[model samples]
Target: MSALETVRIREAGATLAAEAARFSGYGWMRGTSGNLSLVLDRDPLVLAVTASGLDKSELTDTDIVLIDGDGVSIDGDDPRPPSAEAGLHAHIAARTGAGAVFHVHAFDAVIAGHRWPGGIELRDMEMLKGIGHSAHDETVWIPVIENDQDMTVEADHFDRVYVPATAEVPEVPVLIVANHGMYAWGADAAEARRHLEIAEWLVRFTVATR
Candidate 1:
């Protein structure tokens, strides 16, 4: 890689570390239970993903690995392997054209998924606007897929339920894995984080009230 590309990767790593720390503080990414990725290049789909088995809150900017669209590590110098969920991240980005993907084991997400295995529908709430839905008189369904230990199988399940955004409907940038966690994404890191937070809040509210 060229010097500029190397610099970009390092920058993305720092961003990922900061995001991880923030989510960890929220108690959504406790232990090494979550992962985040940033798309570095779109054509061939290069990503900077958090390294596996590291404490999210304690991660440094260097605690990241480069991976391809297939989630295969490209940075040979980095001894760490990508997060086990990196392939799911890659699949989400590839399918949705998202620039950043975040997976967190939020308690509410797990509860919501288990309670509504088919999906969770949120409507008539002002917070719904936060996830690109109308604040009132509109509904959004957060997709949920069964969990699998094999990443490839998980990716396949994701593909089966994936929905393309349309002019009439905004894309729901979040997904929940039954009894597992949530995945959220956006065109960039900030938006991805926003989507995750808003989705979690919506789910929490749903779980609390009903």
Candidate 2:
């Protein structure tokens, strides 16, 4: 299913929350350091996203909130809000039809971004094909954007810059947030989780074998 594949806000919200909750166990997104999202519908425009600053490890269904493309909360009576990077997830879903976007601050991904500061180049890895790339020779250019406090500005810049830069390579589903985390997207929440694992593996391998 594509990101545009619509579903009820409740279903979408629950799935995103569960995925975020599970990712916490990997010890990468430990202590609420990541966010998750899935597009709910396209007509009225909505997304189910993880609430901001919540501990992912012990998340509940209440932690999810439906938001518009601009990150406006639409559903859930909860007073808390979605993740700050929620806008970036919406921007990606709008552009890529990615059913889910999972982001986490894995040590290797973050360290690689800081060491490279521009991007991380992955090559000659057989698992590269898992993301649909045809050859190990294919280099995935993970955009490394400088982390910002203003999620709005960062989201705008992501669309204006990162999207355009990687438009020619849609198969690459992961992008690095400098000194922050890796943003991984896929056709659904399960796919997103798998890609996040693969992305983390790729970066970890790159760092280890360097």
Off by over 4 Å in 2: 1-7, 160-170
Query: What would the per-residue lDDT of candidate 1 be over residues 1-210, giving only the tens digit for each residue?
Result: 899987887899899999999999999999988999999989899899999999999888788898999899987777888999889999899999999999999999999999999999999999988889999888789999999988899999998888888999998999999999999999999999999999999999999999
Clashing pairs in 2: 3-97
What lDDT tens digits, residue by residue, belong to model 2 across residues 1-210? 344432365566667667766777777779878888877677766778888887888776657777888777875566787788887888788777888888888899999988887778877788777666645556676667888878777776566445432545655788888888899888888888888888888889888988
Query: What TM-score goes with each of the models?
Result: 0.97, 0.87
lDDT of 1: 0.93
Q: Scored by CA lDDT, what does every candidate get? A: 0.93, 0.77
In candidate 1, the residue pairs with backbone N, CA or C atoms under 3 Å apart (3 or more residues apart, or in different chains) clash, namely none
Window of ten residues with lowest summed lDDT in model 2: 1-10
lDDT of 2 at 202: 84
> Model 1 off-target regions past 4 Å?
none
Best by TM-score: 1
